[model samples]
Target: MTKTLLIGGNSAIACALKKNSDREFISLSRSEGSLDLDGDLNELDSIADIDGLVYFPGTINLKPFAMLKEDDFVNDFSVNVLGAVKVLKKVINQLKEADGASVVFISSVAANLGLPYHASISAAKSALEGMSKALAAEYAAAKVCFNVVAPSLTNTPLAGNLLKTERQVEGNEERNPMKQIGSPEQVATTIDFLLNAHKNWITGQVFPVDGGMSNLK
Candidate 1:
């Protein structure tokens, strides 16, 4: 079986992916281990060769532009961009050793869409998307594909604050073109497909699973 490392694997989407996929998944999470995004990632140095990796760590720091501080931007970038960079550096060789491995990142539609109170996260995720494309080009020679899955208003604990009230829920749903919220499985399927890099020639692309919110009216 192909072994895939899931950073922030305890997340709803990651857990859904692990539960439904036939591939072997090894999860690392802050809730279960010392896997702090801003802390040492030395623990990942012990991992061996793996077929794939999916980064699920992210932040939902939403606030008005006036209320946003420099630290807000820094924290968002640390978790969403720097943390992934660190994890990738640790396992790039293992992925290359696999010869056709893939790396999937969890992004947000906010990165592409100009949404209110999303300045910090949008900037961070946008940087992440740019970095993924660069990595994909840098490692194409090694056949290590890098891709991203961007979802909008997903029904996950990370988004509890946004979905706390019925009015908020209805408002969010109405804003989407699909008129509904995205589920963990919906986003998971996209990541799962990208993880099979050995079977597909896809690379350096951002796949939006955002119910048409990113592109459509």
Candidate 2:
């Protein structure tokens, strides 16, 4: 059985993955019902072997660069970058113990594409991508693979404010080349693929699950 560790259990994408996945899932999140990563780092030490890890915690702080404060950047970084770093450090050994482990970090298309009102999140995710690549190279000898999945606006609780109304949804859809808003299931499937044994050969890659928003004009 594949042993998978997922952070941010309450996240829509994480929920979708958990529902459809047949693998053994160990969820860590701040939600009252789940194992809290913030409460205990030692808890991760008990996990024997981790075949796959998916960090789902992320922040979306959209604001004009002028209006963005220092705390805005710091807060986003804390959740998106530092949180992943802490979790990975705690479970690195378990990942190394597996024959070939896969680590997937959720990123955003804004990290690569120039988008308005995305200063804070873009910066944080860009740093995350860089960190993932560096760790991927460092852990290659251990047969631990690290990769990132960058998705555009998906229909999720986190993005509720962005898609609150029909006009808002239509606006975002029209912006994407696919003329549609992405679904959590769509992004979740891509993440599921990355965690599968068949993708052992794939590593240090950044996959854009966005509907051509990062590439197409």
Candidate 3:
């Protein structure tokens, strides 16, 4: 069985991915133990070879331009960008050892689409996308693939505040070309595809699972 490391594995999408795939998943979540994103990641030392990795840590800090503070951007970047960098540094060797490994990072449609109250998250996710592409180029020779999955607003715990009421949900749905909200399964399916390292020749790409929100109307 292919072993996949799921950073922040307790997330809704990660759980959905685990349920839908036959690959073995090893999760490290802060809610479950001492996995702190801003701190040391010594927990990865004992792990052996891993064929795939998915970084699921993210934030949805929404506030007006005026209301946004420096700390807000720092916090969002810490979770969305720095955490992925830290985890990747720790696990790159394991992935390279597999000879055919894939790494997936979760981004947001807000990174490309200019949405209100998404400045901080957008900045962080945009940085993440750039980093993923760069890593894809750097690791291509080693057969280690790196890609990103950028999804729009989904009904997950991390987005509960924005989707708390029917009016809010409806407004969000109406904004999308599909006139619907994304689901964990929808995004998970995309991540699963990218996780299949040796099966596909795709790399240095950002697959948007945002129901056409990033491109269409």
Report the Cα RMSD per candidate. 2.0, 2.3, 2.0
Model 2 global lDDT (CA atoms, 0 to 1):
0.87
Error of 2 at 3 (Å): 1.2
The residue-by-residue lDDT of candidate 1 on 1-217, one tens digit each, is 5589999988999988988888888887865223265454676677676879999989999999999999889888888898888888888888888859999998899998898899999999999999999999999989999999999999999899999999999999999999999999999998999998657999999999999998899
The TM-score obtained by model 2 is 0.94
Would you list the C-alpha lDDT of every candidate in the order shown?
A: 0.88, 0.87, 0.87
Q: What C-alpha lDDT, on a 0 to 100 scale, does residue 26 get in candidate 1?
A: 82
TM-score, predicted candidate 3 vs. hidden true structure: 0.95
In candidate 3 the C-alpha lDDT for residue 46 amounts to 76
Model 2: per-residue Cα lDDT over 87-171, one tens digit each: 9888888788888899999999999998889989999999999999999999988888999999999999889999999999999
- Compare the candidates by lDDT and give the number of the best one: 1
Clashes of 3: 0
**Model 1 off-target regions past 4 Å?**
31-40
In candidate 2, stretches whose alpha carbon ends up further than 4 angstroms from where it belongs are 31-36, 197-199
lDDT of 3 by residue, 1-217 (tens): 5589999889999999999988889898865323365453676787786889999988888899899999989888888888888888888888888869999999999998898888998999999999999999999998889899999989889889889999999999999999999999999999999998556988899999988988999
Cα TM-score of candidate 1: 0.95
